[model samples]
Target: MNTSTPSRHRRATRHIRAVIQILSTAMLGILLLLNITPLLAYAQSETDVTELGVVKLANALEEGKITSVEAVQEYLDRIKAYDKKIGDKPGLNAIVTLNQHALEEAAELDKERASGHIRGPLHGIPVLVKDNINTADMPTSQGNQALATYQPKQDATAVQRLKYAGAIVLGKTNMAEFAMFWDTVSSVNGRTYNPYDPTKNINGSSGGTGAAIAASLAAIGLGTESCGSITDVSSFTNLVGFRPTVGLGSMAGVDYNPLGDAIGPLALSVEDAAMLLDVLAGTDPKDPWTSEADSHKSDSYLASLKGSTLKGARIGYVIAPFGGYDYSPGPESDGIFSTTEDAISVLEAQGATVVKIPLNRSWWNKYAPQNASFWATTGHENFFVRTEATWPKGLAELTEPKDAINFGDIVKGSPKMEKTAVEWVMGDDKQPRDEAGFTAAVNARHTFAQGVDELFTSYKLDALAYPTVAAPPAKVHENPGELLDSEQFGTHCGWANFTGRPVVSVPVGFADHFPVGLSMLGSQFGDVKLLGFAYNLEQAAPHRKTPELTPSLLHTAGSTGTTASSDPSTGSDEASSGNAPFTSSSGMSPSAVALSLAAVLAAAIVLISLFVRRRKK
Candidate 1:
């Protein structure tokens, strides 16, 4: 029967099976390694859509290098990953409500692009709107718990324009409740931390937008400024903020002070801000204040961008605003002053004349007091009435405490609101609301406007430059309301608002780990010129730096994201970090690592297969 031969055959079969099993194990390992490579590379290739400026994103879309859906998804993923909470790192509570239909809208826009119908420069760009700005698709909570469910019937004029330009509404960002304070904290969303330093507060009422844009949660943001909300937040977050002349942009559908408020853009660069302004600046039938917008409008704000815009231009360095003589400097004064001086030097090198001018102390003292009184008394009453009338129907009828809907009730409901109310009342020396004071305040504004005109004429100045905030951003307080600055009116930003002049705040540099912004103030309706000058300075100095805490999550080829680079030539470090590709902690980007792993896996698989065949033969 040959039993020995049969046993030998069985042993031979077992050995062959064992070899096959070992080869299979090796192949699986190789396959796993190979799979990981592409995954890693794909991750590395994932673009941080946040870093792309409006124009750059538009160009990419036009070139079919990216899709609106991909861009929108990246922002959504970033928001989901870091908006509410990042890993151990303090979360930026920037967004209050994300547009549920963002992806769908983006898909539609992408389809439109495929059909050869481009909306505009902002087509398919995702933007964040300050919660205080009305949005039909999202609740206009104004970062107030009481108004948490309140949704507007229509979008704000600015939002409408953004949508008209094919810009996707990513979401509404948190803001000061009722747009009442400077710090971006509210009863609904808690507080938004500074992207650069979590311990510091993001100046509001546009603080959420500032933080969101700084963190790259959205491509650009829309902020409504009453006082220095826009500029202060921008200054603190190292962004470029534009506050147009009071009436240049519509205040319709936005909570604002008719005399002081304006809607503008907060962006990573001056050019992007200008592009937004180009779309947003126009006459609005709903906002009578914009009646003169057509006359004030330029052919194209984007066209005004030129390196030569600053050449032969006269810029006034208003020292008093930055604590030159009258006001004392804060602890961060040296750093602030140094960066400001450096900015001035950059302007000088750009062939612009920089003059040291003293702020009109006498004028500010005499009229500013009356204006303050008026703003607190008659001005407050007017704003309160208007806001009440325009408040969401649900908010307007709220009566939990029988008077919860009124401004006084809302103020008394919370200690923070009460404190802000006290400051507002005491700000004007507790002056009683009177027609005489109101008239006087109205006259003061006109007088201040005239004075601004006179100063520019006398100095032959193109713009007045000063620190956006008197000091660096104040540290965030345990009591969010405690972070509100009562002395904001004494700063340069308030003066610009009072006179209804257009102002642009550009990040100059970092001082004491906090960003310092330089503001350029121009005559009323001189927004185009202001933007042009800002563009020139931005190109020359380029001071905007991406916050370290909110670095890009993915590496992409030729991403024009800002980085901290020290270049002696520009006297600033806001430019690119050079042509070298970005790398992750692994020394290679995820994509590069994946490709290397893929090659290794292929070689390993080939070798294993060859060995197995040779052994089998």
Candidate 2:
């Protein structure tokens, strides 16, 4: 963690520049303007079972058409055929550990259906989960070596709910290391690329789950967020990611959660996300906090999935909040934001009134810094640090422990985990604060929380909406120097986390070939209403397009013809988007440390040369 090693690799910067030039020319927005059919048209063109989500598949299965195993197998085959093609270049590595017993479990479900015992809504559906959630049948490694073989004695409460609903656990998805970073670079599993562009970041720490659902690796996946981990990455990966109100879903059996991290659903369709949320939302005696949950804890969340649910809702938009960090808003980010802005327009068209709101930067700056401390004290501690202090000697080496964790870094070797250690103590370097800073930050967080409460009360608003990120996905290893522009967006989206309010990130549009998300921020515990608005907007925008893995015109053509055309972008999808435009005025200006030093050296060189010439004379 040398804080001063040039923002990125020199080679990565060159590649990013080249890709940006190509993308700027062949932007997705241009294609949308030309009236090219969206990627979703593929489902309309064919009766592909893969195109159908869990609920539809369940109906088909119940009607004696498609067997449960058949549906699960189709998703597995999809993972095999299109995993790498859609841009997660190495193909889709969405799945970390495939349940060897998936086929067997599906067989059992089919038999149960034959026995006339229908489980429920998620019955017979194959669902993927973020690695941090525990499952009795499989190892739940929170993407760490330390718990490589760790297997929970029981399924996490959420997983249990899925099982009760008759969903088959397909596998454990990949994630960021200990869910520490937003990039899916795990010490154990390498990286999880964006399903749309493998070369770019899928958006972590819940990236694998987002990519899995977007790519249809599984009908739905569960992703957890401490801050923007779920919502931000889901926005980038073109999926629906929900962060429920605190203590809504039972955290029992989840590997992490010293902080109040809530696990929610990521899916291709918002309805599917809602279904999963319904199954998972309930009071659990094991978690004392659940006792304080809103009285609506037991409400049927799925009942709010009506298409007309958004009518008459009041929505606020944050247009300028995140624009500050975007140096090069990729085609995906740009397209998605425009699409979302247009979506808000459409919502207005559909009778929902929209209002513009200027964000409070002072409030954001005050409380936002505590997110690292919150995450570290909560989820990070329960999952990793606590394990170190409690686990038996050589726990990972025990008899085929289900979770595929590699703990050598934590236990056996005194590895140079100083970087990881530092993160545990502080947070990400880009946003760091000290003890006093954190204390002041905690107070600031309360003030900001109060502001949000006031906004909710004053406006009596249903929800606030904004683009998930300043730009779309960037290639992995892109020069970090360029991402300064959209930092404010990250800051803005992140404020909700500090406030402990529920936020839903739905894929509404694409920008610069990357996926941009529209977020719905609601009154505390207004998860259902936020989701309702999203569902309505989703229909209006209906722009979910599958990325064409290969560079083919047909891919860019109507979905029925071929995959989408490939957009030129360099680096990994998980890396930072190329250099964001720097603003000279406004905000904490980032001094160009490297460039400034280079200038200083050049001046000294000229002075020395002049002195040398004088001496020679």
Candidate 3:
């Protein structure tokens, strides 16, 4: 039950560093005489930490090159270095609250690793969760100032799955207020700037995860996508994002509109995403939507990655401006489109049959209006009225859980609410309701999903590919008073969301230094197959580059970090992606903690020197 704050952790690390400095200074003369620069061999580990992803970090832990404690502390240091305002510039502000007991949890995981009981692929990996997702130890503020101190009774279903898998819940990140905004601007934590370009806004509700993971603040993070929240920001920030079928992942304990909300991973690569999905994709008794999960989900999404290649695969590529909707402004559209075209050519070069799937302009024109009706007109009120509803009750001023959540009461409870969010609770209710229109919209959606399915069937396609986000990152000032980015020319998320299908986004390339992601969608319950295609694309065309804004910091296991990729993607089409070969059966008898300390002892002295330099600055 004992926990420690960041300051306390810092004091402890400082004490360790002080002892290291004294020992190192005394041994310096002897070490220098012998030219014992053991730490310098991997002195670049701290700087190269940006190069390591979730899978690589996991591999390091399994290999005894690092421990969960070192990895956790490394990310914490990165957060301290870059998350808040530092020097003359604005920081990412991605992290909303640090989990005080993260180090404690990580140390325990290390003990388990030492005891030879590995939980799963995520053992010891650090993750940043979106603030809207409930964590028992942290407040689930939903990015509203009024609910800033609102603590949930337990962790969300997805969070429980993560902890059970041995992942560290490092902290909570700021998110779009109520997961409703296009830009992640919260009244409690303000806006999260894109690390790709701090002046621009990465499209959100999942912006904090986008920025944090993009900047290497954590090994990976979780983000909820109602529509394009997960993929859009991931596209903007150059990270891989997956939005599984609506019911594939649980939404219980997460304050979301059940109509289209789903929880998924924002990670460095498709391999890592699939690994996380293995843990998250399952049926939850608390959520009725997940009833199909146990049936639909594969035994291991990672298994799908084995021997999966795009060669001889039928991939339907969207030749854009296809539906008379271009994804960017003027020349920028052509530039981004050109970038995507060049990347898509890799699909063919890798022996995949790339079939052009041009969407009809009329289909899109009618679909837009129908989509609006489906999202805006139905299910919201009733969904909130269900037993899962907790809005009004979460507000500090409104303690009665029995009270119905109303806009007027919500606005009254949080007087200093973000302006854009206030419209949700402060809007006039005098507008007429259209039951007939909603019914028609629902009918249209079914027909649309069926038609799209026929297209896949007719084409014999495994997945359909398109530009994830139509445009590059938008300037923070570009969309004033708007919930959706006004500058976006194209986005295909609604196609997957309304159809209840699986979709994923991976970095294709960069345009003028801004990241662009390619989206591939599959039929409902075909998440495993979809991931295989993405894995092929990821391995063949790895475009992920570390953000320049936030680099690295002094780390614990600097000497033990891997230079070559431990990525499972290195395997051939028929072989498993070499996923750290973890098992519950006993192997090494030596204590993992002892080995981790011994492995990094030489490096800790180097880290101390770096730490002192950082402090002086």
- Kindly indicate the candidate among 1 and 3 with the higher TM-score: 1
Give the better candidate number (1 or 3) by lDDT: 1
Highest TM-score scorer: 1
TM-score, per-candidate, Cα-based: 0.81, 0.71, 0.78
* Residue 58 shift from truth in candidate 1, angstroms: 0.7
lDDT of 1 by residue, 298-411 (tens): 878887786337888899887555222357676557777788889999889988999897655675665454324434253343433444333444444443334225544443
Task: Score residue 316 of candidate 1 by CA lDDT.
Answer: 89
Q: How does model 3 score by TM-score?
A: 0.78
Which 10 consecutive positions of candidate 2 have the poorest summed lDDT?
574-583
In model 2, the runs with Cα more than 4 Å from the true position are 1-47, 82-89, 292-294, 320-337, 360-444, 478-491, 550-617
Q: List the residue pairs that clash in candidate 3.
A: 307-573, 307-574
Q: By lDDT, is 1 or 2 better?
A: 1
- Each prediction's whole-model lDDT (CA): 0.73, 0.63, 0.72
Regions more than 4 Å wrong, model 3: 1-48, 319-329, 365-372, 376-405, 428-441, 478-484, 555-617
